[model samples]
Target: MAYDSAHGFSCDCGQTEWQVSKTAKGSQVVCYCTDCQAHLRHLDRVDLLHDGGTYIYQTTPDAVTLIKGHENLALQRLGPNGMMRYYTSCCKTPVANTLSKATLPFVGLPLKGEDPRLGPVICHAHTDKGTSGRKQTGFAAAGWGILIRAARAILSGRRASPFFTDAGEPVIHPTVLTREERRIASLRR
Candidate 1:
């Protein structure tokens, strides 16, 4: 599915194999917060978010898949930890979430590879724009966007945080990371 290399790789379904590449388009979405870094760290993605907070992207969502043994999909709530997070048991592909009242499998990585045209909406999470320290331009914009979104969301009775939404409504509760998870995250630092 990726537009890069084609080295054979294993799929959940043993019968069918997939292709992988060494080079692909890359992105770094600055998170500017610790939770953002922790999420990636929990997934051994610390290196990907090195600049304080940025989700590095390489393979398009469409390029990644669970063509076989999709039944092995297992969801874990790492945010609430005991609450909701999504991963495929077979391959641990970040699938979606199911924590809030927004029904099961609430949120997860999009299968953007399927429809390249539709990209993820940009948002600034945990941003207030009052912290004046960093100088990265895009990071600043993301922070400003976060501030604007938060103001709009709060005023309009909408969810300000974009990551965890309950029933399409912004969750008002705070996210908790376990001590063990935090300790593990420290390793990435």
Candidate 2:
């Protein structure tokens, strides 16, 4: 499908800006996973969290376009095998999360607030890890949507990633957090 519209988002310092194509095939979800929470805490961006979860638009990396301040973009991981979390060094705004490799073609952009353009939340993931006391929903639909989007992205050649190079390497090297850092970030408030 062709991109129909674009929604812009920027870091707290407004130094890093990007847009997500509306046509991106994926799901809008509120992820309450501990890792998600820890990521925000690691960046000292707990203000981005809502109801003990992070609102994320899970889509293909090809759908994201960096508008400016690419130099401020930074990558980090909670551990050696954790998903790469992208943020802006200028203001510590948690931007997106992705698989270890660009070939995976997935990007989960954390939303500061709900955007009607991305549609409604289709899933409430990892509620068991949430402090909100809400039940998980729409797991099956979200799972199928992810599989379908991933399959289509792979078939389409996984091009145009804002965070990765044409050679499938990250545009910037990732910093793996120390165990102490992870422990501190994971501490309950």
Candidate 3:
């Protein structure tokens, strides 16, 4: 539950592996935004959803390090301006979401269970957009935390993101979904 220790994660097929360092700033949350749901649906990975939401650890980019299978990493977006979504082409496992530019220093790592190391869900974001019927709370706190960490990351000049190059470019090009694909994925089941 503490970021004071390292945590590792991998794709379903184990082809891609990554780790978050002990000193990384992060928070856990269950996000139920339509965009998040649509992303999973687009990948045919609805199985990753729990109670109509995805559990994620929101952290700074400098915190992550790709351990292996970098070649298998792929990128996508719901639309031209959507967040960059990373996944493993080997098995279509959702990896993380980040701003189009790595300089922003944020990554939302999709997780499976309530791994105690992630600490706790600091927020239930966009609950109104989900079918779980849960009330939304703590979003403000989470937002503040993210902003604070982001500022700190920027100030510290920590730019060693696994998802980006030293020059602040994405590790791979992104594929933007078509309008039709987005519509279909956004449809409520």
- Whole-model lDDT per candidate: 0.39, 0.85, 0.87
| 70-187 per-residue lDDT for model 3 (tens digits) | 9999999999999999999999998989998876778999997566887878999999887789999899999998888998988988767888888878889999999999999977
Residue ranges of candidate 1 with Cα displaced over 4 Å: 1-33, 47-68, 79-83, 103-116, 127-178
- Using TM-score as the yardstick, the better of models 1 and 3 is 3
TM-score of every candidate: 0.40, 0.93, 0.94
Candidate 2's residue-wise lDDT over 1-189, tens digit each? 123487788888788888888677777899999899989888887888887799989898888888888999999999999998999999998788988887667889998867677889999999998877989998888878877888898887766788887787888999998999999998846
Best by lDDT: 3
1 or 2: which has the higher lDDT? 2
Candidate rank order under TM-score? 3, 2, 1
Best by TM-score: 3
**Candidate 3 lDDT trough over 10 residues, lowest sum:** 1-10
